[model samples]
Target: MATTQTFICFEQAASRTDRRKNRRGYLVALLASVLLLSACEVRLHANLEIEEDESGTIAVVMAFDDALASMAGPELGDGLGEMSAQLPSEWQAEPFAEDGFNGIRITVPFESLTELQDALTALTQGESGSDLPVGELMGFLGDIIPTREGDTFRFSLTMPAGMDQALGEELGPMPIEASMLDSVFDIRMSLTLPGEIVSHNADIKVGDTLVWNLSFADSVRTLQAESMLTSAISGALIWVALALAVLVALVVVLLVRNRRMRPMAHSEQVPEEG
Candidate 1:
């Protein structure tokens, strides 16, 4: 499919439109999250929804405290603009920001797996776009990646390496004090893939969809293990694979049977005795 380039964007300081987040009413039953971090208090949430045609919507919401935000000021003061420039102009949508948190909303009218390949590469490298490190984009957004099997597609999101250190270097590491280990740094991610869910490692699973309610501490550990955040398989796809395997086997059997039967079936009758 032909694809026009696009990127994430937020509005100017003058226009802070309050676009309510997509409540996910249609997807509530389909999505759930299984991972959760015990102590971290910071939170970042990315919600992605895609259609069978590859067209979909992706939204990323990140929250940080003033102290930490100020520490990374030089690298990310521009905020949404940092992430917006990375996306193609076609997919640009206004971003929203509040006192301590920021949000980017984008509508992907149409897309192809090829485009997702770039997104995946960019995420792994921790770069939202050219020249901008994920550090500048707040790091949480780069964790998401896309995978495909047959006609079905799977996208998984997890914390990227160095992010913990980056934040630690800025905001400082989680204090040893037991009181500080809960929801201090949190990141929530959600998305629906193109197939029936085969299996997943998330904290919650509602149908084939995934909603991740996780804390920074949990995500950091999960990232270290590189555990699967979410996975899905189209129910129809399972049958398709089985059907193809069966068809191929049948073809081979038929060919072998024809070879074995040909000589005997065509053998001339021995009339000499008669």
Candidate 2:
């Protein structure tokens, strides 16, 4: 009888311990869900714009830092070699290999508003319907701009709000018109994306447009590069949270079982002493 009673006590204690462990794990899981729900997620936004002349020639105007212009042509003859450097290999097989893109160009790199203004003035004066550098002459004729030394450029484009959102995602092949705005050249654009449509925004030209079939593909590569770091950080946070939850549940189970055993052990000792 003593042996049977001892065995029954052990089984009951084990069952209670198991139930407590289950409860701890359930609570831990609930806490984990709450933590995850409370965590803030950073949104990744991409913006891209394309400017094309009336002749079906396209120039991709990127709003990124001016450092990228290093990959642009020196003066339209440095070949596709320079641009291919800044882009994915797929670009080589398309725009780089096409003839229309051969005519596409880069603008002077801009470091500040003053520099940008200088380049614009230079372009405007040079293309003065008379004497100007071939590069500036091209701008006067509403052709592509060269990638001059600079950080940013101002092109005239009448853009709508929808285009702004789409530009954030870098979605492509939108229509752009290069027209004259009195003395200024206006690069008017109209884009319709998955959700909305943007009608107008004056674009400031900075670098040369990447012409050719591969322009779109090159853009995707750039967009992917910009977003990769953010995505990785988000994924890591998710895993870390799950691991911490598991560790907390283990600690809770151990503490609960220890508390239950201590009381039973004290009671048994008292009986022996009596």
Best by lDDT: 1
| Candidate 2, poorest ten consecutive residues by summed lDDT | 177-186
Q: For each candidate in turn, give its C-alpha RMSD to the true structure in angstroms.
A: 14.7, 33.7
The Cα local distance difference test for each model comes to: 0.45, 0.29
Question: Residue 218 CA error for candidate 2 (Å)?
Answer: 23
Best by TM-score: 1
TM-score of 1: 0.45
- Per residue, candidate 2 scores C-alpha lDDT tens digits across 147-226 of 21122222232112222222223322233211111111112222111111112221322232211111111212110001
- Residue 95, candidate 2: C-alpha displacement in angstroms: 12
TM per candidate comes to 0.45, 0.22
Give the range where candidate 1 is weakest over 10 consecutive residues by summed lDDT. 26-35
lDDT of 1 by residue, 1-274 (tens): 0000101122221122221121111111111110112111234566676666666666555444554444445444465466567654444546546666544554344387566544534542432342332223334454556655546566555554332433343233333322233325355666676545545666676765677665423435341111122332345557889999999999999999999988886676534564
